[model samples]
Target chain A: MQKRISQREIARLANVRQETVSAVLNPNSRGNTRVSAESRERILRIAAEHNYRPNLQARILRGDSGSNLIGVLINARISQFFYDLLLPLEVELRKRHRRMIIGQLGNDAAEAESVLQNFIDYNLDGVIVLHHDISDGRRLFNHYLPLLPETVFLEVPPGVSGAAAVSIDFANGVREAVAHLAAGGRRRIALCMNDLRFLSMQMRLEGYRRGLEEAGRPFDESLIFIREPRPDYTFAELISDAVDLLAVRGKADAVIAGNDEWALALLREMNRRGLPVPGKVALVGYGNILNICRSTTPELTSIHHGMEELAAKLAAALEKPGTRFPPVLSHLVVRQSSI
Target chain B: MQKRISQREIARLANVRQETVSAVLNPNSRGNTRVSAESRERILRIAAEHNYRPNLQARILRGDSGSNLIGVLINARISQFFYDLLLPLEVELRKRHRRMIIGQLGNDAAEAESVLQNFIDYNLDGVIVLHHDISDGRRLFNHYLPLLPETVFLEVPPGVSGAAAVSIDFANGVREAVAHLAAGGRRRIALCMNDLRFLSMQMRLEGYRRGLEEAGRPFDESLIFIREPRPDYTFAELISDAVDLLAVRGKADAVIAGNDEWALALLREMNRRGLPVPGKVALVGYGNILNICRSTTPELTSIHHGMEELAAKLAAALEKPGTRFPPVLSHLVVRQSSI
Candidate 1:
């Protein structure tokens, strides 16, 4: 192992105070003008000779114990939803003079673990983990919780109690969406979801059952459409099959989708089948991705997951560690698709 | 500032070797079994008592110069394109046993500068700067190029020479699209772009002119449709106005858009006005974001930007620092919208 010269050693070699060495090195520092030009020059020369590099981690420990770096773990698959949460989180972090390092935790579990390990190795001041599923969240909590500093989970694992989290009340949002469809006198409502293995998908399913029971309608298992677990099968193919099951074969009057992307795709598929939305079949989607919802014909009706509010809560959790924030509630944004 | 207890200090306190202390501290270390249980217990006790935190930076400096951290600078505004590049880059980095820390350089210059500074402070091994525009790239180069280690520019600024870059040949793609339309007997071919201030957009405009000249057709300034610089106006509004200008007002027989998102929106806008795509106005788009191109009706014809190839080149640039990669050429994928 090669030994590197520290700021103290450099200061001693230059015959100047350690503070002078720090000021000369830090471009952002205002104290450089206070030091004599000759002293600054000497310190710079000695530091350059040894190829001195500032120890950011050591500086954090000695100065304030805050790295001012927040680690954000996100999955790139559900892009629009992830971006919604991330953009606002970045803004909120910037407001507190903090910078974010995003970890693209794709579908690979091993890759995801490495990303988490990297965060710990960096000794980040805080961590915000946006889970793809509850099981993944649980795995992270089991291994890395103690090692992580000031951790905030966007979707805390199901049974991991008392963790700092900012969660969406998807169950309630879907429930309201279904009830709205039911109140509109639509019978045989269909629910379209991707991968029921996900805790979020399970929550939405539960909400659908409750909404049906509340509306005095029977909860039929046949009415629920889950995406086929085939890698070659596109979301378009899934939507096409879903449109057939709901509108063509099953003759379902209303449908609720997992996200706006799926719902918009479904809308196009239904249009191809000559099924007029809100007339032949009413449609609703979760994650009111505004641009997507607006650009579609007869603009989509969606459940507005309050990403900005969730970001604020996520930031607040970091600020006041151990304070439990209530789950961020979602609201139904009625549009022509549901009218 | 309180002094941190190093591995040597812990070893001295436990009356054991520094290797023993290191084995006791590192969970991933395979050397733990060689150390005696008594020594291990003593080392652990001393480490815990002192609240010893591992200095990862020092470990990097001592053992390996590479931090194994690659900083990726990106703008979150053009999300689909950004994600297309980022997901592949993450995979490529993972393949090389390196981790990526994404810096979302969202529209704020101050924020972008701070992100670059953070990358330097962390002593990242390599950096991949995905420029939003040529001017922004130049600004980054002028300020941080000398300070950065092993930097790869995704889009090298117009004038800067001898920088490792993975750039898209938008001019060639647009030129091919224009020539294709011209050969198909389209009288008026219009070009729709966003922010002509971007060198990328200007390159496409130049290509459009070149294509017109090659086909013995006069270049018309009125045929170019640039997005209005109003913050309140939505992209949908721009697409709607563009449809009116190209199909109705100008009676253009063909159109080429900035991206798939814009082309998809334009297709829908044209559809809403009872104008059939390709039959009435042949449409082409750049950045063939596959999912979007697939889902849209008549399936948009677009120039595929080859993000995977770009990612490979970017990773290759980091591996061989001084090597320059050729500009990644885009190819047009014909679909129903263009035919």
Candidate 2:
């Protein structure tokens, strides 16, 4: 395969000044630099011949990205969690007179790279990376952070730095929920969660353990229910089994669900089996997605995610770069389900 | 507001060929046209002095919009319908090696106008208008269709011509649902729906009426339940009232809900009141959103919207303009709730 030619190499090959090559290629920089139309066409033809793809990062770094376009990087999944976070983010960006163009990350590293490259090519003024998969998120973020300086990560890993970010205190809300449940004289409190693949979910589990310890209760593995793949068992059936074990067969009197959806499922299963929520078994859910939380039978107790505050902080960080933002705290919103 | 300067006007002012002006302003055209750097700079400076915003429509029409960027126009609402449609659309676009950029339409015409204008400015190759509000949707479609020739409407009104469309046959599914309920010995069936502000919803209601006529039953006005705001009533309360009126007070033995969420709410209420879903009152819902539909105790019977097919058709229409697409059909998927 032939080596790809750079703009400098194109300039050398075309016998024109490097600045002239730059002017010919980047339309944004051509305002002041005057090159003959003949030279412009010649440079373009040569660059095309050599298959010289412009390094979007270099081009972006060279000029002002005053496009008033904010790129939002989100994984492609249809969840209420994404919708709740994005609605406020879009509203906030619109308020700031900025247009949001979503860059939906595909499942692989190549897809992530291509999307990031597109963002650079489009010359987006700022970017907000929201809850990407933990497997490659750290690698991608560490690699691309320097190239795209005006990036605000929604929830970065513990130590990564050098860019603006608005972290969420996911653990705090679970701790509070456990303590609240404990204070209400509920014993054998259980934590129902999804698979512990994501760093955020792992953090929640840690919080649950700490909460149990703080409540002077021994950390019991039996009380930790993780939803995973089981042959011939649908999600509903799994939830039913969990309900049977925790509220039906076992002596568990309280539970903290991973999310509002899980909490609703548990509530429905409990209701189906003739077990009363808050009477037989109390339940608390995370991510206070209002539509789901409000529609449930008992108007589910949930942890407020502070999506609006997080959005505001993200917009502010983008608007004024290098400004330190405090971590957005998650708090328990006690409702009928957990009383 | 200043009248926007056309490329021809700028060409006349600069004493250059209109082609030269076009080549200078649009980067894509510069590969063939050779204009001196001096003339290029002069033309740009003159255009700037006159506060000329290059009529993106004229530029896009004159040359090629080889920007493999497809713009999806959606209203700024957080709903599952949008998510379902968009996921498939994105996947199909990606399969075609095209990148998708979302243009979220705000509440007003001005906002829609701005979003559409932004799409043009970004030089998007094609656009897909997906279920904009009825009030401004028609007006906007008529206005922008000429400028953006490579456009497709998801559910265009009858008699809307001259553009490729991949509409869903929403009425057919409702007709099927009503017929299915009637065939199962359901008499005095009720239609539960949101406000008939949307043309699509109105079509569903029409199908309901037609279904009743076909089933040798009279359309009862009392059985048509529209969810609207009443003072001192929450959404849950309104749904509870609908359930009472349809199943308890009235002689309606079956009900077809507007959407899955509404159906779920009704089912929950019915369960709370100790009413068997299909035994006493057969139930049906629209938009077979699997996650929600499958989670309900007696899995929801719903109208399967062929969103994947719709998305594929939209993608095809955009890829090859002038290709006519048949309207995507919706069908009833009978589940535990309606059996």
Candidate 3:
């Protein structure tokens, strides 16, 4: 067995204080902790040479702990979007010397409650709830909300109270998407959404109406399609039915999907039905998932939801604690699907 | 505010010992602890009626904590496979009252080492390393392997020692795929793989050669295509080049992809080039990602890695520490693309 070198030895060898060694090794050490660059490099080099690795568990147990752990609560079903967001968020968190503990919330209220309980048990510094929804939303808001310690709700439902939030300006994206389609001479544009209960969806509906008004076009009730919230309602089937209702009967010339999955589903169904996209029925998607957008034959036009900016804001909020960050904005990314 | 009822209140009301009440609410409580069904139901119903929720945090802080925390470390990229596996594993873990903390490891060795350190700092009961790859494999084995506490490595690299592992037998899947193609009278079969450095890829290559030998066909080195590990290697371009190489030069009649993504990419490129699928170039993918396989035009033939079985095994291993579970087997799922 080899003898392990401690931070004390490294500090003595480098002619610096033990605190300087600690600050250099610590991930959460801020720039305010002044350590000369030459000393820092020398310490690091010596540590590397000696294969010095800190016993973080012993340090944490001894009460010399750094507040670097943050909990991220995500809805289990819609994890793909959250996962994409997490890739960047994790990198940013790493840069700041912070770590994330992810808790996947199942549809069952009890399970969701248990996850929240576990987060508290873990003694996380703060939490970020990504698309918060439990079976009983009222109970979550009324009882659980008060128990939450330094939390930030992302894409929060309407009328939820007493927490810092970083919400998406979905209406702004929807407006841009609608305006773009309308400018391309798409008069009778239809809207397809997954869930009407989500505040973002409601905002999109409002945006659709406003977009229509701006284009000097009347909003047709029949042109809108909202899928019933059921596990069996496949995205492809819902979009196929929506195409039949809007394109075949309602004579809609353009369509805007609630998200990229809906857009991809619409494209697949249209291709099956021999519908020429952009030539006859233009389509636009939300969430601007670049891979999915580019994968389609006629690359999908989508609303960019600024995931990087949102992640950065969430990280900032987590650090400051109790600070309410402004809502992240969205815009349009035009592609071949919507001309 | 309503008065919060404690477990003691429930126990007193239900005429049972506090230990019995503890056993009832504890997530990790095994079925061997015999409590009468009537007493169990009564305690549960009474607690529900009173809206009693366990204070897990206070319980943990009081040194009466159950070691139910499991840490899952995943490669920063290839998280989709791990995430899919996690969906089922989380459900299974919840049934046993265990919670998971995920640590994402980047390509950088230092970052990976740091994540491992954090996992230790958090005092996790056990750990699962999903597709473990630190830049220096030797350092991972030599230095970090000893530090892993009750860990199970999924799809472990070749020649790794001193850890319980559950590896997918990719060779069996590759052999099955190749034999199926051979039986369909496809003489010249090509194999496309990503990162030959992976033990699984090496196994697949061996399987390809063995499959060819079994079919009494000469092993052609020209039929194999391996891609360099680069971030920007898009699926479409990779498959497009593979198709050109095998179909044009090698004159291959069948192709087996390293994974489902590659298979789908090949299907797309072949479709664009107007090549008749099974009639001209039969294709098979690994990891039968059901949604992607079914989404393609002719559907896709793929290898079923048995994700559910694998997840179940992982959960069982986590429950009984130091027990090495048997390797999960893979088999072929013949879809339309392969005939």
Candidate 4:
């Protein structure tokens, strides 16, 4: 096998200091020092002849100020909502000349730890974690909190120390969704959630109860349905049972779903039972994932959770470290399903 | 700013060789050497005291055997189908203890070049390009073909040189879907596609024509709907126009959509027009995205394009370099929409 060449070899071949070679190669070092044009050309020629490229990883190991790499940690089971958030985030990062490396965290704490470890081992300049569960956040804080000064957590519960967070105001969003339904004379309102253990879902439940009380309607525990969170759990059976309990027995006139997935499943079950949307049982979904909303018959009305704004704010926070951002509010997008 | 400590400094502090320190730090280096338990403990203690972590990326640059990092290149606008593909791919990669970094390529050629450049700069062991357009592929092949020895292109056109590819047999899949629709007493079958420039869509068109000939029906040019690809083209108006052209004018009894997105749009239009699925106009969708298929009212009948199998095959090719893989086939998944 051929021996690989390095910047040291390039400096030896060009008969210049290694720092001179680095100054010629490093884009950030260009303005600081002046290498002779002839020596620079010789270094470049030697580098080209040996097919030598600067190892960014090595530069990072040398404690170079910037690696220009950002690590993004996302949940393993990402939805269209995350993709929507990521697109704009990538655009913003690209504008700053930063490349993103994504790590997927599974439901298991150990797997999430390994993913975070990989990010650290790679020496990423900063990290952005999206939608990590509260328990996972606590575990991560306990073990790796010191490494998170340059990290930002999105949609994490408030009061997490050692890292910045940008949480969605899900409570306000759910209140707006429920109030919209109530204003339309939907007295019997139900809340459908998946895994209330998540901090965001717990906030949604609180918002649901608050909206009902504000609307002068008693909170009905029987109307709230919580199911296990799994990709394979289509919620078909769960939503069917919910329809029986709310629409058939309790005469519920409206329901607020935790996310678009549950809302779509509820819509499917309603269609199966020949129930008229908005006329008989109005429905509202969270995370206004536009494609899923528009694809359904009588386009789903959903809470617009400010995913783009969140991405923009995250980019700003990342670009200017220690820049505090306020919690973004989620608003309602009234489409055909919720009148 | 506080100076960071390296493994060499830790080795110096612990009075051990740098190689011994490496062997202690690297998980892969443990089996080959026998460091005394006391020495190992002292070295580990010193390393911990100095807060030393090995830079895996630098090791890769130094021609170390493995960094266990895979870079996946995805299109900017990824759908649920892509996520379904990625879920299994990530699982398979993780089984081998390899972490994945994803880079998104935009429509602009320059932007795609920058993304591919980032992948090369990162020193990823391998790459997988999913569903990139032909022009982008050509640009990549022109500029970065030599860097793609361990790269695999998924669902890309044939004849791309210098890289392995795992292409979906869209022709066979479309043929199976159309035959199923025709077998159900549908003679005048129409084809709806977006962007004929894509090789996959072109193959779908051929399959549509072949299925019509197989069914002893002439291919009606009026029944084929080809629309330009756009992120915002909801296909509602396009499918509405197709419905008018096929059901109202051409008297087509069935339609084959290019993918699930278009098919769902068609279903929405049919539901709005009070047309019964399969009774009045049967619909078939390609790429059986599970969530979308199950979310619909009648449940979408779609072509199962073997996303899991594709991911498995790609992982196999990546795991064993130079392994040749045959083209995978797509099959019909019968559901209520077509039957």
Candidate 5:
């Protein structure tokens, strides 16, 4: 193991006081006497040769820390989605020596604003909100836009935007799923949905629309079916009614759902009705809920949202501002159903 | 709503500048004489009334933030637990105007140490460790003790020591469950376990032994069995040999599992052999895994570890320095089996 040189050794070698060494180490001299540029460079060179990284904690204790702390707001109700994304993001942020804090917002914009205001009170460098309804989302931007301190928001639906945005690109993710079905010569595809209120739905819909338009396949509205998202909804009559509406009104050679949970439910309903998935209706569920959905008759081909990549981009956005990030693309994880 | 008074206003009112106000707000200031004590007091009083707070970003950018960041090392594997606990702690910390940074140590202690060391290098005010093993437990006091920063460890088993700890008292929790069973007239008891090596299991076992002794019942070692935890084990022969051994040697009237998953497995294993739970063997589980144990032949009587309390304590420990937390006591929620 290599021995680490101390600040004292560097000071002795440079023939400068320890205080001078400290000033150079901080990289930011607020009220302290400005050291000469040449002297600063010589001190740094000597320090580098000795591999003398000034104990950062010692500097912070002396009132200097370059590492910034940022808040990340995520409500508990949507914790399932939030945690899945956060775990990777935490790792990435820590790597760049930036600290991340967690925050939860109430359902309304007022509470969200309160939480945002609280972050401001704490003097956080920036914030990233995981769940923001359109109304609340607009309010968050309007509140923080004045400060504009590297603000970031995730999953804000297209069109309603303020702040540096990063989201799993559902458009490309869903388009690939549809393209896979199209390649397999499937027409009359159905887009199953739980709710169209979420930003994710818009992206899924965009991809679904784009795939059909490019394939020259007529978009069939009759086959589109809406169902309750609850897991227990499998036993409810609404699921059967929705399946019946899809099967009776028209034929759907493939189905794309708003998200993974609904897609799994639709697959379960289809399986119960003796539908042989790909042979009957090829399926692709968005988001990576494959661990639970893989057991279905023909495992649903799904989109991997690339949590690692999204985390990387999110970290980079926080680290090096002005570095453009194109929307993170989700890969089509080809499975049994969409084959 | 009334607008918040800026720190500038307080500074002006107190015959000082905004930076002076900032300096005054820092209660932990060792000896910065940029502002007089009289001006500091006057500014604080006015700021409190007007709800004036420091801007975190400006303070950090200007190299002056009073808020401390606490780093927590959490187990990366338990996604669900991470979501449940970390979310509430975040909210509470914000109320105290502190920030938390999270690091996940996925089964590797060395990696966890490196992550924790980085947090220290960044001059984090405090640190909390969740799910650290016995092997690395000594390092908490050994390597980290010299720094003398506020440190806390959670879920430490019996022997590991040398730092403040916050733990769920599963022993007392299980003792209460056993007492509940004793009250319901279960004299003959069998103990089955899934995670015998876990801290929870060890506490539960101690509870079982103490509960039996309190009830003046003899401890039966022959009836005790440990099995690998899984869902597949539930409906099948996950512990057939243990079941037969307990039945023939122990002749137990009631069975208590180390945790909920193991309890469910035992329940179904017995059910498959045409044995009715509670009729022949009253069964109880721990840690209420939602829905699976319920909707069974005899709904399980499960122990409820207060998630809210746990979350609250976790946050409190991060901010306030306490010798140790009171052991967590849980109530057994009776549905059918014991009741």
Candidate 6:
């Protein structure tokens, strides 16, 4: 093994004085002493040549510790559908004079848990974990958990014993979307949804049922599409069944889609058959993917799941430890697809 | 604030000793020095009542610092085109026992520059910057460059000087996509692109010209479409002249799309007009959105740029300094659409 290049060696290579190299190397060196232009250039070239790096160990030990960091672990990539939630969370955290350490989750659930544990071990001042179907819910409960730092879990239902919980109220949003379709002179209302067993989809399905019963409409079981959330599943399966239920099988007047992406898929399918949106059959979707909603002709009406609000609440839980907040309802965004 | 709750206060509140409180605080406190379980519970109960929390700042200083930590600055949202690149970077960085700190560019370009400047103040061992059009080109020439910590800029051509550079080698990727279309007996290829003024797009267009000249086809200016990069632009604006020249005027046989998403958009527009992809007209796209390519009926035959390979090289750059790596290319993932 080679002994790595030091600050002294970088100074030697740049052909500048060591003090000049140090001035550029440590941006916050005392007394605000400035380095000359020629020396600065030479020092940079030398640092590149020698690959001289600072000992962050010594620096952290001398009291400049965390730099106001909070770690957040989310299951999916920051999707357009969810940016409404995360933008405020990131911005608000910064406002409170804290920075975030974000770890994007991948396929493996174990990898997700491992990343969370690693963040905890790193001494993050607080943590906000975005919920997916985690395998370690039981594991999180097994031990008498340490009096850990302030922690917030988003998307998980409230009152998880001691932890602060925040989530978008999906049930209310679905209710509004379903009622909009049902009350607008539509009967035999069908639900185009993913599995009704998942927490979110289940709530949406429940809302659909409630909306149908109020309008004296029979809930059809065959209309539900359960794709099981696979990465490989073509959304075409969703549209094929959804359109068939409304256009062929159920003779339905309106259909509620599982999500905005799936709704867009159905609209494309309808466009293929030359079906005019809302003119022939009404449709609504969930999780408003903002830009995409606009591009589609006749645009998509969606239930906006207050992602930014959820993120803000989650961030507030981390920042202001003493405040207790409950789950909030989602808002509806109407467009040409449904109206 | 009010003398902030500490272990000493918890001991006083619980009516137990400070040593017992310390033992309760650190569950793994050196083996065999056991305090009574009842005292431990009481101490913890009092600590919770007072909202006692450990400062992670002091702890991280103890555990980390000497080891490696690399920072990455990206202009796009975690949702956008960069996921294919970032996921691999983190995976490879973890394998090399180094942690990653990510910084996202804000709405304004100047704000993003300050965000990049943050990496220097962060005391990062090294940094990988995803520099495309999102970052201002003039910032490259500015003498008051943020004192970066051994930075590497991607997609930036060589001879610009100052930092190490890595690029996707789209020179080869474009050559292959165009050559594959040209060799399939298609001539007068039309190109549909967005934001031609971007530095990266300039290189891609150059590669397109190089491919066409090699195939002995005259590059017709009339067959090219340049629209605003925003997705909200209607298909009419995007397909202007290019489609008219290809379909109406019979100027071209195949169309090379701007990127994967743009290709998909063009595919949708063509599908609406009763045009069969590749059967009636050949098409090729770049940046391989794997999920979309898989689902399209004819599927998209696309070139997969080695974002994963770039990430692994980034990780290697952080660990093994002094050598600049040439950008890597992932193979063309052939699906049903092109052939």
Give the per-residue lDDT digits (tens) of candidate 5, residues B1-339: 134466677878877877787677755445555767787678889987765655544454345653467677786565345555776666666677566778777666666666756665544566777656635556553655444356677765355555577778888767877788888888777787766667677788898899888888888778788767476565246567656666545777788876665676666567666667788778888776443344344667878777778767866775666547786687677877656
**How close to the true structure is residue B181 of candidate 6, measured as C-alpha lDDT?**
79
Clashing pairs in 4: none
* CA-based DockQ, model 6: 0.12
What TM-score do all the candidates reach, one by one?
Answer: 0.79, 0.74, 0.78, 0.85, 0.68, 0.71
**Per-residue lDDT for A1-339 in model 3, tens only?**
244577899999999998899899976665466888998999999998876766554444444664467778876566467756876776667677777776777677887777776665555567888856777865765566655557777865556776677878888888888888888988889998877777788889988888888878888899999886467876556777898998888888899999887887887787778788888899999888765676566778998878789888888876676676668878989999998
Considering every candidate listed, which one attains the maximal DockQ?
4
How far in Å is the alpha carbon of B292 misplaced in model 3? Answer: 4.0
Q: What is the C-alpha RMSD of each candidate to the true structure, in Å?
A: 6.2, 12.9, 7.4, 4.3, 8.0, 8.9
Rank list by DockQ: 4, 1, 5, 3, 6, 2
DockQ, per model, reads 0.28, 0.07, 0.18, 0.42, 0.19, 0.12
How many Å off is the CA of B173 in candidate 5?
A: 6.5
The DockQ-based CAPRI class assigned to model 4 is acceptable
TM-score: model 3 vs. ground truth: 0.78
Sorted on lDDT, best first, the list reads: 1, 2, 3, 4, 5, 6
Per-residue alpha-carbon lDDT of model 2 for A192-261, expressed as tens digits? 8889876678889988888888999998877878887468778888898788777766668998999888
- Encode model 5's per-residue lDDT on A1-339: one tens digit a residue: 133467778878888887887778766755476678887898999976654555654444355664466788776565356767788888887677666777677677776666666666554566676766535566556645555356676755444444677767778877887788888988778887766766667677888888888888877778677555466565346656766777545667788876665566667677778876777888787776633344344556788888888888887776565566788887788888787
Report every candidate's CA lDDT: 0.79, 0.78, 0.77, 0.76, 0.68, 0.65
For model 5 chain B, the run of ten residues with the poorest summed lDDT = B289-298
Worst 10 residues of 1 chain B by lDDT: B131-140
For residue A304, model 1's alpha carbon misses the true position, in angstroms, by 2.5
lDDT of 4 by residue, B59-173 (tens): 6665665657687877656566666677678777877777677677766677777777677666777888885763566756545757543778785444566677777778887
